[model samples]
Target: MKKRGIGIAVGTHPAGLKGGGDPSQAQIRLKPDGTFDLLNGAVDIGQGCKTILRQLAADELDVPLENITHQNIDTDTGPMCTGTFASRVTFMDGNAVLAAAADLKKKIRDWAAEYFECSPADVEVANNKVFVKGVPEKSLSMAEVGAMVNWGGKFLVGTGAYTPGPGQQFDPETGKMTAIASLAFGCCVAEVEVDTETGVVDVLKLVQVFEVGKAMNRLLCKGQNNGGAMMGIGFGLTENVCPYYPTMDFAVQDLTDYVITTAADMPPVMVEDIVEVPHPNGPRGAKGYSEMTASLAGPAILNAIHNAIGVWITDYPATPERILKALEAAHA
Candidate 1:
């Protein structure tokens, strides 16, 4: 007999430490060609932080997207940033970039006004041009302003550093702690099919809903959701880093031994809903949601199996043998 099952789980893991003081820093530089550079310490592990940070820089500075070069190479030059983890890059690192952009924008506007012999308020930068308000005919190319600043023996550079708060040391005796700067939440539902005879389980559908503050990039959010769902499936079904028990030997040695779910293993149906609720301190009210749906997938899959087979399997991977044994014991 074939059976259908459904499982659900929630994730409330935070974006960073509660009241921790770890800071993320960024530096902004204006070049003579009206282009810009963003130097930060946050390493983008292909999670799109580079693109997201660059977007923040460009938007805040009122510069063209193509005018900014993202730089995060070495500690020797890159601004200091707390290592990327806990899904804090978007919220923490982003704030730093926002501040840097604001600072650089002010300096650029100042020079733009000087070149026009008007009050800074009279000039605005948009679409890569610094123009006088209500007079389209009078405009200065951003590159011209930069060239003037350079010839005047000045460079535009701004730095921003964000630290949530001074970390409070937890009371050793009471375990009391302060609140975190921000928190991200998500919910996931998994639908699965189980085979009674062979004890094989297949994930058919996965629906995820998340509170991301804002979608800095909609496509990036979707990619993160899908990627997290598949990884969650693997975590619940396969890809165990340490399979052996107390001996601590590597049961699955490497790629050949480890079995991670691939595209073929993805669920047939996947739905993602992104909720935008602006954060008070986050850059443009955006927060991190990269790993929010990941941890929930495994539990939801496990619960779905229980809903179908009516057998509670505690051990992970829930291989065919274990399922059979659990069925036998339940019937016994």
Candidate 2:
């Protein structure tokens, strides 16, 4: 007989380093052709950091998206980042890029003021053009300005760096300090069907809700949610490094022997929703959201399994053999 059950779990993840003082830096330079090069150390490990960062730069610089080229160069050429972990890229590195763009914008405005013989406050920059306020005719394209700046023996560059909070401070008595710059919270509900006779547990559906501060790119956020859901399912039911417990002997050696969840194992229905609650210190009000996307999936599925079979399978991967053994132990 197959029994069905549903369960929900909530999880939270922090952005930036635990003890604070995490820093990220960025640099931006304008090309003669009016395009921009944004250099940062935040690598895109398939999380679409390049796309979102470009979007941020374009928004800040008041230029078209294609006008920016985001480059993740080596330490020799790019700014320093405290590696990409703890879901810090979107929050920490993004702020660095925004700051760089702002710095670059100020330089452009100052140069335009000099060229137009106007005050920097009187120069207006928008849509890749610089003009004096209330005088649209007295304008020049960004490309033209870039060319003039280069010919004048000057290179336009902007550099910025960001560190969360006012450095790492500790309380003298309690030893507590501000850990994370920001936080992302999420909830996941999972439905599962368990067969008592054969000990097969099948996930039917997964629904997730996340508070991401802001969605930099909605499509990319959806993709992350889907990918995280799949990974969570794998953690709940299929992936195992040590098949033989209590000892490290005869462990699965490679990918060939390892059991994992594939596309065929995904639930039939999956839904992800985003709730935007802007952070005061985030870049464009966006938070670090990558890691929390997958945090609640395993626990939700485990709770569902207990509901279906009335047995708590405390072990990871929740293999059929383990489920069977748990059921036997419960009924005995």
Candidate 3:
């Protein structure tokens, strides 16, 4: 006999390092060809940090996205970044990029003002052109400005760094600090089928929703959501490192002994829903949401298994042996 059940779980995630002091730095330089080089240390571990930062830079500098080239992180030459984790890259590093772009824009305006013998306040930089405000007749392309600036033995550069304010305040009694800069919320619903005879559980479908502050790129956000859902299912059903623990006699050591969820094991992602509630302090109101999804699916799947078999799985992976033992104990 087989039974089906549904389970749901909700969760929240914090962006940036806990207890504060997390910092990121960035630099921007105008090339002679009118392109801008954005240098930062936010590594892209498949989370699309590079694309997001470039987007932020393009917008902040008031230039076409194609005019911005995001330089890859280089330890020796690049700016400082406190590594990428805790969903902090988009928010923390993004701020640094914005700062650098703002500085660069100001420098360009000042230089353009000097060349036109006008006040810096009267110069406006937009769409790859610098022009005197309300005096459209006097304007110069950014490419021309860059060429002239470089040829005049001068450099046009901007630099910026960001830290989440000062150190967070901690509770004296509990030793807990106010650590989070932004919060992302998520909820997941899982449907599963359980086989009574073999103690096998199969996930049929998943519906996930998340409040990600802002979707800088909707397709990228959706990809992160779906990928995280798959990871959650794997943690609940298939991936395990220590098959035999506490005794430590026969631990699964290699790939052949270990089990993981594959494409064949993936369930349909029925709904990929995202809520865009802008954050006041985020980079264009964007927050970190990738890590939150990885956690939601496991508990939801466990709950669904309990609903199907009337037994709770206290451990991860919920291997067949454990499920059968739970069932037998319940029956007994």
With a 3 Å backbone cut-off (N, CA, C), the pairs that clash in candidate 3 are none
lDDT for position 113 in model 1 = 77
Can you write out model 2's per-residue Cα lDDT over 192-307, one digit (the tens) per residue?
Answer: 99988888889999998899999999999999998898888888887898888667886888876686778898899999999999999999999897888877888899999998
Q: List RMSD in Å for every model shown.
A: 2.0, 1.5, 1.5
lDDT of each: 0.84, 0.88, 0.88
Clashing pairs in 2: none
User: What is the TM-score (0 to 1) of candidate 3?
Assistant: 0.96
Error of 1 at 92 (Å): 0.8
Task: Tell me each candidate's TM-score.
Answer: 0.93, 0.96, 0.96
The order by descending TM-score is 2, 3, 1
Which run of 10 residues does model 1 get worst, by summed lDDT?
241-250
* lDDT of candidate model 2 versus the reference: 0.88
Worst 10 residues of 2 by lDDT: 162-171
Candidate 2, position 100, lDDT: 92
lDDT of 3: 0.88
Taking the tens digit of each residue's C-alpha lDDT, what string does model 1 give over 182-203? 7778999999998888888889
Q: Which segments of candidate 3 are over 4 A away from where they belong? A: 174-176, 247-249
Pick out the ten consecutive residues of candidate 3 with the lowest summed lDDT: 241-250
